[model samples]
Target: MLLTLAKEIGFSHAAAVDPSSLKAQQEVRELCAADRCGHYGRNWSCPPYAGELTAAQKQLARCTEGVLVQTTGNLADEFDIEGIGRLMQLHSRRFATLARQARLLYPKVLPLSAGPCTVCRHCTCPTRPCRFPQKRLSSMEAFGLMVGDVCRAAGLPYSDGSKTMTFTSCILIMQ
Candidate 1:
């Protein structure tokens, strides 16, 4: 049911995933700490502010399963930064909508997106409280879960071997 809804909502791919298989590795968190994306400590949903990876992992482990979703798009070559950004924005929007709908079925549904929460242009972190706590999104990396690993555990292809870009996310339903 969730998978169908995901497809209807415009996700390129959706698959059932076992929460236990989604391990939060220290290496992944370290990458976030590196701050190459310039998102670390800048928001309530990024690293440091997103909380410990162990807590995220434990919470996800308690869930029975989840729906792994992805948005894949052709980027006129790997350097198509504009195309990539557009696809990512599309993915973020779809993810937010999906999460809201998922909450109707499971009030405690946890949404882990492919990147930092962008609901607001500027997040007031390390100072003021999140303006939209209910709408905040925590990235998969912030949770320390490697995207490729999650896709493999979910029996989904992380890459189709094509020159395309794919952003992945998941909504763990703790029912």
Candidate 2:
């Protein structure tokens, strides 16, 4: 069922990642604090707001299996940052929706999106508390995941050099 959904959603690659392959929590925290992605403190799901990476890692460790999903979209050029962002959000929402359904089959499913959680147009996540914790998902980078490594391990191409936009998302299922 999940595979079918991945295909339907235009995901070029989809496979389950081993939870054991995740990186150390401290390493993740360092990367988040570095704020290279620029979303580190700006988004609710990013660092400085999402809680300690150690805690996140511990939480994810409970999961045994995870699925990596990707979607590739064409863009005019590299300057299309807005276009890429929009495409990513579109895929992110779709990924979350599918993840919700997957949770029905696997009660302990944890979704890790391609980017920060965008459950609300204007997130009130950290100010108070996550408005929808159950539906929210962290990014692979947040967990110190070397996305390219994981993608290669899962037999998925991390890039195609098409000068276009591509989005990837993942969900961990605790079996």
lDDT per residue (tens digit) for residues 22-93 in model 1: 788889989999999988888899988888777987888778868999998897887889998999999999
The candidate that achieves the highest lDDT relative to the unseen native structure: 1
Q: Report how far residue 88 has shifted in candidate 1, in Å.
A: 0.4
Give lDDT tens digits, candidate 2, residues 1-175. 6676666766667887777877645666687788777777777777777767677778777888777898787777888888888778778768977787787887787788887887777667546767887777778877767778878777788887777766778878765
lDDT of 2 at 115: 73
lDDT value for candidate 2?
0.76
TM-score winner among the candidates?
A: 1
**CA lDDT, every prediction?**
0.87, 0.76
